[model samples]
Target: MIFRIVFLCLILLIIELYTFQVLKTLIKSKPALFSIQFISLLFLVYIVYSLMQFDRSVGQTQQMMFTMGLLLIVYVPKLILTLTLMGEDIYRLCVGSVNFFVDYDKSADFLNSRRKFVSQIGLGLAAVPFLSLIYGVTVGKYNYKVIKQRIFFPDLPDAFDGFTITQISDVHSGSFDNPEKINYAIDLVNEQNSDLILFTGDIVNTDAKEMHPWIETFNKIKKHEYGKYSVLGNHDYGEYVTWPTEAAKEDNFQAIKNLYGEIGFNLLLNEHTFIQKGEDKIALVGVENWGHNFKQAGDLSKASGQLKKEDFKILMSHDPSHWEHVVQHDDKHYHLTLSGHTHGMQFGIEIPGYFKWSLAQYVYKQWAGLYENLGRYVYVNRGFGFHAYPGRVGIMPEITVIELKKGVNVA
Candidate 1:
């Protein structure tokens, strides 16, 4: 980890040097350039000092926030400037090579002039991402948007028609710096007044103790008519942090599971339960943490043991990769699956119904929103809270409400 950090810092430092060199043209005064560089150097030094002094045991929210701010304010803009500068350099190289070949007597002044123009253009182009990242840190992170989706299934029970299910996932409580804001998000969840509520894992970042402060706040989340159900995500297994002993890790996992119940959530681990309305019933199957490259504790066979293939099953698996690798083509057809591991990378451009994209798409095919394959559907909620990075960019925190409709559509 230390080596990785050092390597990353070295790369960022190089990029910063190059970016500031180009920026020198904009601020032609040597004193002003020196002042800006000095301030940036101070910020970088502070970041390193804070990281070294940060407390890992309690989840260092302040330190992480600072680092996130640095990334947004400094590194991200540098990245844009670097890329733009690289493109111009490539173009200049091609043009210069042609000019040298055509006329051996040409002076270097033209290339130097183009270089200045390229630097200015690069800096100008860099502002869009810089401003967008600033917005992400200040407002986008807490911008809670509720996405309501209506899913029609021929197998959906008649009694469950129009049944509303609110799903939230990846509540990385350890990263939260504002409790009041979280309380408001919970209030929004209750305001939906859905019949059932499902949480698709990642309740805490790395430790169960991190959630102690928010227990009561979460308990205040109004119960749905059918009840609230939760499943363990990869982080819930307490695998990210080191424990003194195996038993200690087990204890932490148990405490988290217990906390789920304390806050009115039916913590499901490789289990199946039925939610009934009148005489009609649908199976809600929940498995432990499961992903292609992540934890594989989820046992589909065990969770679906009591149900038949014909049952209308809703599976809650934390990582959407489970759907692509396991659930989609399984013998026991799962009508729907809910997941939230990707967090949409907490960044990306999303134009609803027109163009939706994130770097996360390259990593996970079903990173966010609804996807269907072989009549089995999965909706990957962006997330309910921030995690490693303290803030979100284009992808805001999510509150998903899925309304189940019964019927078939012919198109």
Candidate 2:
């Protein structure tokens, strides 16, 4: 732990020095420069102090979230400045070497003067993420987008062909700060009026109590005709924190499970239920949190129960990695799966059907949106709440409404 701390300090120190160089190059006012440096130093100190205060026993806190936000806001732009200056330094070094060798008779200043325009350009580039991150914390976190998706399946039960399911995942309720905004998002979910609603979980960051205050706001969601169902996400397991005892952790886990029921959802735990439509029915299988890199409590075989491979099924597993690794290859042949653990890393560019990209894609193959393999499908929601950094960027919070069609998609 000490080594990690020292390594971090060294990195921060280097960033600070480079950032100071940029400020020195651009500004001539001594007072203004001193003020900026002083403020930056204070931020750095506060961030270090807040991070040091982190307690594994208690897990994530609002103060920690604030520290993370401040750290990113302060450093990301500075890192950009550092990189820009480093590039210029490389050019300067090359020129200085040539001048020293070729101009031996005359004394020329070792290197060219730092260009003001270069610093200006660097600052300009830095402002994009700086403003974007600020906006994310202040506004983008609650900016919920109801994304509509249509998936086609040849084996889809005819009666449920046009079924619409609204999926909201990774609520991370503990991170919520604005009651009015939460209510607005809830209203938006109801407005979708989909046939069924599925919450592919995270409901809280760690503790179930994190969701206590918002239970009423979430309950405001009108009952769906096809019923509300949910499966647990990794965070719902309360595994991130250190518990005083096994009993305490178990109690917290049980409470988290109850939170779903309080919000009018049928908590499906390694189980399957048939959503009947007249004489036709399709299995709705839900499993506990299972991820390639996380908890593996989910059991697909147990969830399938008596259902056969030929059954029309829709599986809800929290992490897309579960599908990427297991469900897709399972002989049961799940026709469609819904997942949302990635949250698109809560930062990415998505231009509808044209283009979508995030750092998360490198880690999880099915990071966001619909992905298909050999007639099977999985839709990864972009998440309905923020975590860690306290806000989102290009990847806004999402509420997914998916329509299941019987025929193959011609488009």
Candidate 3:
């Protein structure tokens, strides 16, 4: 607790100090100095107010002050640096280009290039954090809801027709220090009326015990006829937290598995389950913690083991990297894979006419949402919880309701 507070204070202190330095530099401009100083003092007041945080009431306010405090600590300095450094470079480039074309100013001076310099600073200041806030509120707001959509197997038997699946990934339950918001998220999922709930890893931060208070809430979550299924995320297996020993960490993993069972989840570890939608069945395969580095423990072979050559398959692997590393190239060629680990870099944009997800560049060709290659499909969930960073920036908290509509099968 002390560390968290101090850590927050230090970064914010840096921001305060940096802002002061910026103001001090603007000493020649009385208005700039006064304005900067005034804003810094108001932020100081907020810092003082945040010191009153109590664990008892932690559930009540959503830790608004603490979250804001940390975000500002994070937001301000970066805003300053981004607005400063980025503004300077853009100013030089733009003015230099104009100078080349018009041959108006032979000078390459920073201050003398007044018009271009000021405009760059103005736009840069307004843009970065606004973009960040859009991400934060959309992703961080607990009330933000996502639904599972259903698509059928062209071969998806009539039994599973109209099967609406509620998918959640990267519910970094550890991010929340309270129950109300967590319960609210659970309630939103229940409201979806999904036939099956597939949580594609990242069940908790580092401890299964962290979820003790909300075990009741989780148990109360609504599910479709088929029930809920889950897999372990990188965070779920308890690596992020420090343990007394290796054995202790292993014990925590066992405890986590127990918690999954306790919550009524058929937690699949490198295994597959058959969703019998009549004579046509779809294989739901889940692998354990198959992510970037740490032992790619998930064997696609095991998850696809039970399938016949003609069977349709769906895979749930935590890291989207698995899509590139295993699933797409696998012999069975999974028809659809569900993953959530990317969380869309926990920030980005996707709209009707345009789709841009930064994580796609490195992780998979399709980082978030649905992507199709021939008849094969992959839908990546953007995660419902926050991690490392306290708030969401752009990638909103998601409850993806996937409606799997089957089309003509590709040979």
Task: Give Cα-based local distance difference scores for all models.
Answer: 0.87, 0.93, 0.69
Q: TM-score ranking from best to worst?
A: 2, 1, 3
Q: How are the candidates ranked when ordered by lDDT, highest leading?
A: 2, 1, 3
**What is the C-alpha lDDT profile of model 3 across 1-411, one tens digit per residue?**
778777866766665554454445435688878886787667666655655454332221336535554555445544565456445557668878787667776665433333434434544674676666644654454545574444546776566666778888887665676577777888888888877888887777777766676678788876568878988888777765557789978998898888777777889998898887656667888888776655477877876776875677778888877776667877686877888887676555556337665644575566777777656778888788766556655567788887766555344
Candidate 2 is scored at a TM of 0.97
True-structure RMSD for candidate 3: 6.2
Model 2, span 27-59: residue lDDT tens: 899999999999999988998888888899998
Model 3 regions more than 4 Å off = 1-120, 127-139, 147-152, 359-364, 409-411
> 1 or 2: which has the higher TM-score?
2
Name the candidate, 1 or 2, with the larger lDDT value. Answer: 2
Q: Give the least accurate 10-residue stretch of model 2, judged by summed lDDT.
A: 102-111
Number of the top candidate by TM-score? 2
Worst 10 residues of 1 by lDDT: 105-114
TM-score of each: 0.95, 0.97, 0.76
Pick the lDDT winner: 2
Off by over 4 Å in 2: 100-110
Question: Superposing every Cα of model 1 onto the true structure, what RMSD results?
Answer: 1.9
- Candidate 1: which stretches are off by over 4 Å? 51-60, 106-114
